[model samples]
Target: MVTDRFNSLGRPARLVALCLLVVAVAFLVLGRWDLALAIGAGALLGWVLLKPVRITWAIFAVAFMVPVTIDLGYPTNPSYTLLLVLFVLAGWGRLHRAERDGWPPRRIGAALLLPFCAVLAGVLHWHGVKPVVVGVAPLLCIGVLGWHLIEEARRDPKLILRIAEVFTWVSVAVAALAKYQTLTGTWPLFDQFAYDWTYTSVFDPTRAAGFFGHPIVYGSFAMAMALVSLTIRGRYWYVPFTANLIGLVLSGTRSAWVGTALALGIWLLLNVRKIAWRGVATGVIITVVAFAAVAVNPSTFRIGTSEPPPTWVSPTEPGTKPSPSPSTSSVDSVGVAGARMSDPVGSASASARFERIAVAWDGITRDWSTVIFGNGPESSVRYLEDVGIGDGQAQVFDNTYLTIWHNFGLVGLLSLLGLLLALFWRSRSLAGRLIIVGFAAQIFFFDVWLWLSAVGVLLLAVALGAAEDRPWPTLPFLNGLRKRRPRAPETSDASTPGFAAAA
Candidate 1:
């Protein structure tokens, strides 16, 4: 009778514990650390109710939670960092499983490792241990988590659809938050930032960042998630799909707009045979007509105000002249959406980006050794400050390629480029290839690695893309697109014993 009662209580007890833990973590993220501790203590009472999280589930949890978690502020929020730690711990506990699962496909793993090794070498050359740790820590966490996601998906082909379903729901939540921000002009869960430091249209009320601090990062991520969500074949899937699309537009991120278009185009082209040409043609025609109608009277649709150009006053010389402020006239005249499609040369933001790229290139190439091997991790910020692009209070790089080049030198940049190409080339599914293309396009516009949500989701997308693409009978039309390409002969770095056996 005692055993029966205890067994009957197990599930409800576990549910209560999980709810307590979640609430405690939410409190912690909200900066109610004291309340979090109190709630967390309550959760400890049900410690036996908490079961050990599987490594795969732990990674999925990290991926799902990243979009909602904050990673900024002076002390930095420990919420996302804690998830990463838990993921690492879970993976550590599953070491025996990893030996059988095999390490990340050795080639891609090595490709990913080369840049970190370059960063380590560069940091060591500078005798700065902190930079090395900072560089390697995220890399290690992302790599391990991504490897397991791939392994798990391979083991269960149906897992890919489950992953897509989760992403679709995540997109729905993020999109809903963005819509809320649009309707109310109020940031959820946090106070609105006084200014958006990353973009020219600073403090624009119309641009919704959702949960991520930066609109560009949020928009780019939303685009990727929106694209990934396309794989979902559920009834009424278009509701969330439309929501994500609207969120991406409201983000007012021109680069994300371009990337999404590029990715969508790629996806369509790859699945051209599977696509209904009549429907696509009709949609394209309707879209073109609507665009033409809007183009004829853009002023009617235009809304929002633009602030004056951003100035970077030097700290060393208080009286020194600031760099000429970039013009926001384009933004003012046509609004963010119109300016988004405007010619690059006409926008001061684009011009400023070009100028910065030139300056960064000049600085990076000043010494061949530094150019080839890099000064150290995060040397880009110092170089930017020294060169007078920023006031040391904040360092911003509008370009990920530039930042990577600045931090890890030519070798690191090349390694990353190689890795991207390899991933694209090796991608077995149309959607996987589309995801990579989208991510690659967006990186040219901003430093994507700065935000945990942006980078974490991206790594998840890459893992899904790299995993064996599984066919969904629900989407019989797309089955042709999901067909796996024949495997190439075992290459030293690419072959996995388990993957080979399964293949």
Candidate 2:
């Protein structure tokens, strides 16, 4: 009877079973028995809660396979990775099957570039074989997941909102835990438990870095959650808003503050017409109340230091001597140190970035082949290392556009820019267009374009797939160019006669 039941199962089910078995075995071999158990539990949970979708499964498989790092010392948690894989699979699967048609080429094409770039890097032997391999794998996985999401959204617009909800709740839980840890001096559970420096804030409470390593990452994640919560309709919108706000306040990352505010502001301005004013008013009230409470209790609002000293104030200048008091002197010394840290070109971080960018540009210009095709993926790391800067220095590129230019040259840069432009042009709703614009703003200061955070990826994916108002096929470009569609006349019931009686 058991054998017969097994035989009755369809090919897809069998395939899934086999895949799970392989994953289990792989985990066991890697000595991650707990992760194997978690995977099994997750599989069961996913099956029960989410109807299995083929494209989702495929995308999940692709995403899972991409993180094949030979070194294994890359400081990633096996359980967290498993969770990410499971969620990506379940979420993408649910989305793909919910939609009517498959993913479009433009979307797929954009996603494919990540893996293609990785492959090109490998072939070019940039940053050695390991960096290329490591870099490409994650890109490949993220790309597959992205493609799956785009395809899924085409079927059900609501699915994205649902995914956003789940993501927000999880982030809230994480943020709450981080906050608890911050207040009590207890260690947080998971990999973040070891990141003790995150809690060493004197001015502000350390940023609540739930599952992510850094407070900045956590802040960025919370920002995304806040935006999602605001955009979607839900019974408990305040929950996400409150949680994300708390998380952001605790994170103490100025960049996160800027990014989140910009993103949220743009989202609101564009979609104000569609938004529920009552909800907006309530949120605003809650925020105001919270801010007041925090203001009264200054300790609650504090996170890290106020700011690093300006990098241009020279200690050698007249009347620049350090102060006598310890606190004052410390601040003064920091200022002097910051000034001394400036490069020969009088640029602090800004100058260093400009210098490096100029060098990269020069290198690209010197070779037309490099300019058109890029030196390959991970080439910038190797190039920087060759120029006396260590591998760590390669991370100093603050500008994503500059990084793209240095690593992929003009072609890669243009391709990425074009993708962004296309996505912006394709956006239909005001909210969608604004979200894309905000994301574009972020790329100028941060490298989130490639990061694998759920919030970041979700924001980018949603922005890319959002529906735009396109001209009807039957209408000519110039047809009714200035004519406005007549608004439907408002109707009133005679039985509701207060206004009628007054008239």
Candidate 3:
């Protein structure tokens, strides 16, 4: 009866049954039902679609689902969880032949691995392993997985458009949700200020964070999606494009705004001959109108929301913690008046970021050993406590470059710069180059690497931009920019009607 029932299953069904059976056995052995079930489900799906599923698709999927992290009473999110499952499935060779294809071109691979080597050296020198592990976990899960996707993109040029379409549509939904959250003052993952999100009024007016945990992250992501959506080529493409732009403005993150402008400007400059004048003019008109709308309502469109002042305990009197400082003095940012591109330096947030850099420089260069090898991964929290920079809660250095230098010293910083340079140099399309330069510029404003969603967006950008010397697809107008394939030497048979056209 069992044999007959097993025979009744079709080929695909039989494979799925076998996959589930294997997963069941593994689950019984591993014994973490939540993780096991999640991974098993992912693996089953991957195995079923093994013939068609590529690593690039998985990367894009992770990027799209960043707003939907499944909480399991831990700090973990969907980005890490999904990437972990992909990594495991890759290990089994049931998905992503990028492994067999030798993932991550050599120079990029070396750049990716240097930080881990530095971390290992630090751990051997008696630095805590837990912090390094925690800090590098995302690197292992997201960074390496992303590199594999990039390698895949390099191999399959057509896959870039597929990835971009998936990302663009999903980002439209994300932007819509951000708009909803901003207008309603409520959202599904609204745990930013404990039980209520209304406390944002204590600073500047509320900014839309979506499910990305922070307004800055949401803004940056929206900026990226907007840029990608520009490549979309339908009569209604502007709908998603405009949606992301609205999301970016509602986020009230000046850095992201600046990044978007910088990226667009750079891309335009790079492709001046390729793009049409009408498109640029239309875009400028739209952007100006959007800015004007925001400017008209400056009260609610404020950027640079102030954070609470750090509690001070005087060294002279060890027993007392002072009361909160003056309201004006307590403002951590330049408020609404200073929220323009003309005066980013005037903002208190920018000033604080500069101050952090100065402090980090002093700490990082205290000794030759620290300069060369770094204090350790995730040592910024300890450094912050030692230097009195808002206790250990202020983990990020507010500058990704600074964070890298602090965590891995000059070695790590140089390694990161090298990787960025490689990406920019290797990326053939204008879009890819813009993404690289834009990310490089934005890292100065905040710690771009601390968030998984942000990293996923970066990876997605890399994949779309990794097309080999081809003009980005989707825009028929850009077809003229594509390089003409060299023609084979003409023969007598070439003129014959019977000759099939080259694919």
User: 1-503 in candidate 1: lDDT tens per residue?
Assistant: 95675567669775775688788889988998878876764454234223323444445554445443342331343433644554454456346456676555573465357547556556545847666766655655655555555555656646665666666777777766765665444465444232233322234545777766657767766776777666544655655556567667778888887888998776666555576878578557645543442223223355784344323333357543332233322112125566666676667667778777887687578688768876677677666656666423234567888777777777778877887776666654445666778788888877765456666556656566655544322233443543564554576433332222333
Clash totals for all candidate models: 0, 12, 0
Candidate 1 local lDDT, residue 266: 66
Q: Which number leads on lDDT? A: 3
Model 3 weakest lDDT span, ten residues long: 494-503
lDDT of 2 by residue, 72-144 (tens): 3324643235435644674556354546554467666787785675566356534566666655655555555
Candidate 1 TM-score to native: 0.71
The worst-scoring run of ten residues by lDDT in candidate 1 lies at: 324-333
Compute the lDDT for candidate 3: 0.60
- Quote the lDDT for 118 in model 1: 53
lDDT of 2 at 68: 23
TM-score of 3: 0.71
